[model samples]
Target: MAEQNKHLYYIDELSDYKISDGYPDVRGWDVKDIDNRVIGKVDNLLVNKEAERVVYLDVEVDKSIIDAKYDPYGRPVQTEVREFVNKDGENHIIIPIGLVDLNEDSNYVYTDIIDHRTFSETKRYRKGGNINRAYENQVLGSYQRRRTGSADSRDLDVFKDEIRLREIIREEIRRYHHDIDKDVTYGTLETHDASRPRVDDDVLIEDEIELSQRRSNDEVYDDDNFYKRREFDDKRFKKRTPGL
Candidate 1:
């Protein structure tokens, strides 16, 4: 990979660096989709050395994911190319760092923005192989599309609401170390905590509202600030998600 790409390295490839202190180590943690279905496990983290921060999670997908019916409304990669890419050796997928929520105690990573259907439809590459800029863009684009809204827009919105509610409840549990008074009425989540709800900066899952056109690979690869976007922000991953 070093010969293929000079900037990005797997965590194990770096001798001096380690997952920053104060974050859970999520390697091997189960990755669950919006429906609470396990899709994969964290296999490794891809770090951008220039940014000195982790950018993507390398997930070893479950068998179910491979067998899942492809999402017809998923991203439009060329049919021949996608068929070739989804071969047996390709068992891993890369997810952007900031697009997930963590359950530290439960030992899993979760995301409500991307659904199972979309995940199944995502293109996967061989583990430990070179991940080109175009592949990264495709993965990010898929997640971004789902977050902003998709063919199943109504269903996606409901799922997001439910996920938000669950996160709020979990935060309350972490705060009081016990279940706190909460009300779920009309699909709204409310808490009775006297103190203002202390939402972890990273834990608040962001909606990618701006559907800006993704930059061309040549353009992004040449830019020094390519990884400076919100999706690659180290603070977002460092604060809430796991490490190593």
Candidate 2:
């Protein structure tokens, strides 16, 4: 009865189940698992077009892995084992959907009871070390496309338009300055020549000489007055002198 019950349980668990139709269509190669949670959004897939089969998926693991040791190429090194292991002593393993009994409706898988240690060992064996190389190739191809001559032409046209606009602005500024100069005026004639009375050269010279003589006379008078005051005071003081 026990063996029969075990058989029945195995049959029940192994039956085909459909993943939800709402789930995005993922190729067998694109599926990945972390404990019970599955990560199905793959960045790239390797397809066999002739056979209509997906051979492998090329995905970028979450950047959190970089918290571990990184390689010279900036890719996280897989050698750091702690990030990959779960609390149950089972390493968080990634398995191809092809290796599992997938339930399409539930988007899950079922497997026979497996020891945690054995699962970890199997995961280490199946993990692909050269996946980063494939990613590098894809990046190189994208960069090359951007560097093509056709792409450069579009950039050149944009720069040409910028230069033409600048030239138009410079021409407008020059025209503005030209108009300003046309409206302004300048003259070299003296102010009196335009509206004030003009004196003869001899009369102007005589007036200047007369003014200079008057200033000299005023200075001489001031000096004489000071000398006279000093002499008068001295004589007055002599009269007041004591007999001794």
Which candidate achieves the best TM-score against the true structure?
1
Give the Cα error of residue 179 in candidate 2, in Å: 99
Per-residue lDDT, model 2, residue 187, is: 35
- In model 2, the runs with Cα more than 4 Å from the true position are 1-24, 27-34, 37-40, 70-97, 100-103, 106-244
lDDT for each residue of candidate 2 in 1-244, tens digit (9 for 90 to 100): 2332111111112234322333233333323332433333244333322223233333333323323322222122466645323233221233222223334455433322222222222222112232222232232222222222333454344445546855665555445444644432223233443343333335435554454334334233233232222112222111122353
lDDT of 1 by residue, 1-244 (tens): 3453555678988899898886667899999987889999999988887788788889999999888746433344665544334677788998877667687768899876677877887878889877777677667656655644532554455456646855765454345422332331222555545564433323323211111223425344645677875566545444453364
lDDT of 2: 0.31
- Cα lDDT for residue 5, candidate 1: 55
Against the true structure, candidate 1 has what lDDT?
0.67
Superposition error at 5 for model 1 (Å): 4.5
Q: Candidate 2: give the clashing pairs.
A: 18-104, 18-105, 19-104, 19-105, 20-105
Each prediction's number of clashing residue pairs: 0, 5
**Best model per lDDT:** 1
